[model samples]
Target: MSLVKKFATVASGTLMSRVLGFTREMLMAAALGTGPVADAFYAAFQFPNTFRRLFAEGAFNTAFVPLFAKEIEAGGIDGARRFSEEVFGVLFSVLIALTIVMELAMPLLVRTIIAPGFAGDPQKYGLTVALATIMFPYLMCMSLAAMMAGMLNSLRRYFAAAIAPVFLNVILIAVLGHAWYKGADGLSVGYAMAWGVMAAGVVQLAIVWIAARHAGISIGFKRPRLTPNVKRLLWLALPAAITGGITQINTLIGTAIASTQASAVSSLALADRVYQLPLGVVGIAVAIVLLPELSRALKAGNLVEAASLQNRSVEFTLFLTLPAAAALLAISEPIVRLLYERGEFAASGATSTVSAILAIFGLGLPAFVLIKAFTPGYFAREDTKTPMVFAAISVAVNIATALMLFPRMGAPGIAVASAIAGWVNALMLLAVLVRRGHWGHDAPLMRRIPRLVLSSALMGGALYGGAIWLAPWLASSAPVLSQATALALLCGAGALLYFVLAFATGGTDIAMIRRNIRRGQAAAASMEE
Candidate 1:
């Protein structure tokens, strides 16, 4: 299949999950607001979720896919199967042991790493520990699922792996719905959601497991051993994990820093959700599909194809994300107010704060997506250490800047730190790629980028004026329907104008889009035969 088609499939699934995720956050805001319980719950959830992003999405997939593809080329299905089973046994056993240790060390984890700021409040600290304990087992489930997902992606079965994340949002939304029905208190909601997170993990794991079996690969338990393949995977995955989860690692640091201030963590979390829509849909989809494609091309000694794939992925990332960044900078207040300025959220006076943070996050949206596009260039070559080093540098930048700005700026400062760090990581990756002759300036992409920037700027300026014109309707005192309508119009008009500008300026054109479609169909036909 064509890269665009693969990205669309994954992005469609991600968009569904992100929409439902917004719903879950909406309900959560109403139920918990920015209270102590809310802070505790997000902290608790962030700990496990960070690992899920790090290990499942980041380390495992980056390290696993290329190697698995290599196995298939070298030894066929049977060899790949043997390799998978060997990795699974070791991964499963380590996860179980790790879960047990974490459960036992929950309090220390909560006090030290999870949220040191919570230590001042015994009730909050205890709640965080309890919630984290309940959710810690989720890491085990998702790690196993990641292994299966890597398998599916390498085998060209992208749909199941792409769709699995929806269940996390689905299960959380259902739990929130139940909580609302019962008019549950904050503490109850926290406990319920924590359990829901754990349940969702198991369901997600089962999904990929079933899909893997259906794909004609049934993996069973083998005695855990660090064979040559497993050892090699571990060696690669150790750094790849760090490199892959750069965003999450930075977020965890931000969370810890933001925890010192009241409501700061929750505020940052809300802003994160808004910006993540684009990141998940475009950035993640590109990374996932790009990795295997690049790996295959390079493995077959097709440097030209590898370079083309990298450039296209970068172009695709910016094409989608630039306007998104513009929209966020232009209409973040209305969007945040529309999504979360209801129930306890309105009363908590968090709309302005969250909106400010969202706008700052928008500043970094393109960088975040670019990181996803660039890193695959390294991972496909199995050079994980370079990105890992860059990731460390980015993390240091985030920590130093956040600490410096947060005292005066609060939540928005953390957003700034994350944005700066994202750019640092993305640029470093690109620089190293060019230095090593792995990437070069694609003439077409270079021409389109400035045009895309101009289009986004024009759209953003118009949307800014529109937001001012519609301020009355989007006001806090305005009717809910009026607020929703004004925000929708602002976004829709901005998108329409941006596309028109894009086509007119040759940032992208109908002919190019049509060619991509035809290319995708032709590729799919060849694969089928």
Candidate 2:
């Protein structure tokens, strides 16, 4: 398969998961609103997710996939299996200990790192501790799953790992639906959501485990030991884990600061969910696929191919994210209102707040995606230390900016801080990569980026006007069908116009995309052989 095809496989799965995630969020908004339970629950939920990203998605995958791919290249599937089992044994043991420790220390963690602002409120603090403890074990399941996912991705089996997240949303949505049907209170819904998260983790892990088994790797238990490969992985993983932790620290800081304000935590989360759709679909797809591909190229001493891969990945990222950012900025208010301004989420206040945050996040969308494209340039070459330094700097900037703005601008201020930090990290990564002569924009990327920007700008203007024209139908008092239709039309028209403009302005060429696809497929075929 070509790069585009691989991207599609991952993106399609991500798109489904994101859409279901939106549905789950919508139900949460209806059932819990931006109330205390919602705040408590979101804060609690973020605890395990923070660790999952830090350990599994960020640290583990970054270090594991490249090494796993090398193992396959050098010693074949049997070699890879031995390496995986070794890592898994150690990983499993570590996770079990971590979970036990976290469960016991839940209250202290809630009051300190998780959501210090909740400390004053006895009910919120207690509830956050309880919920976090229930969900913390999810970290173990997802961590093991990440190990399996690394195996799958190295084998060019992207769909199972990419699609696994949908179960989380699916399970949560069902929980919310059941609770809503029973007219459960916000507290009841929150508890149900926590349990649902735990169950989803198990389900997701099972899915990937089965997929890996089918792929000819059935990881089994072994006593933990630091084999040479396991030790090397741990060595590489330490800096990567720190880098990932720094990124999450930015989020933790935002949450802690936002927790001081009423409804700010939930509002920021809702806004995050909106922007995450594009980020997950485009950025994550690029990150997951690019790392292994680049590693293979570099490992084979194919410098030119590695450079092309990075440039095209960056191009592909901008091509998709630019228009997404445009749409988010264009219709943020209407989008938020249509999606969440029902039940506990009031149009009068929460919608505007969330919309503003969403728009701010949009401004940073491309930068966020670019980070995904750029990091593989470093990680593929086994240079985790550089990115870790950059991540620390970015976190510092985020902390300083968020602290400076939160007192004045509140939740949106945190979003602004995040966007600024994203740009800082992305620019630093790109600068260093260019300086090291590790990546550069080729002719197509150079020529097409300007056109993509122009196309997105034009689309943004059209979307803005369309949103205004459809205001009546998009209003809070409008029929749900009318609102849905209006939103869909605006999105459809914006997308159509963007593509048309992209083609007309020579921003994106049909012929070039086809060539890249062919090149990607040819590359994949050669790797397989």
lDDT string for model 2 (1-529, tens) is: 9988999999999999999999999989987889999999989998899889888988767899999999998999999998888898899989989999999999998888888888989999999999999999999999999889989998999999999999999999999999989998888999999999999999999999999999999777878999989988988897777664554667777998898887899999999999999999998899899999999889889999898888888889998999999999999999998889888887336888899999999999998889888888888899999998999899889999999999999999999999999899989988999898897658878888999999999999999999889899999889888999999989998999999999999888889898998898787788669
User: How would you encode candidate 1's per-residue C-alpha lDDT over 285-345 as one tens digit per residue?
Assistant: 8988989989988988988778888888888898999999999998999998888888888
Candidate 1 total steric clashes: 0
Per the 3 Å backbone cut-off, how many clashing residue pairs does candidate 2 have?
A: 0
What are the models' TM-scores?
Answer: 0.99, 0.98
Which ranges of candidate 2 are over 4 A from the true structure?
A: 244-247
Whole-structure CA lDDT of model 1: 0.91
- What's the number of clashes in each of the models? 0, 0
Please give the lDDT score at residue 111 for candidate 2: 88
lDDT computed for candidate 2? 0.90
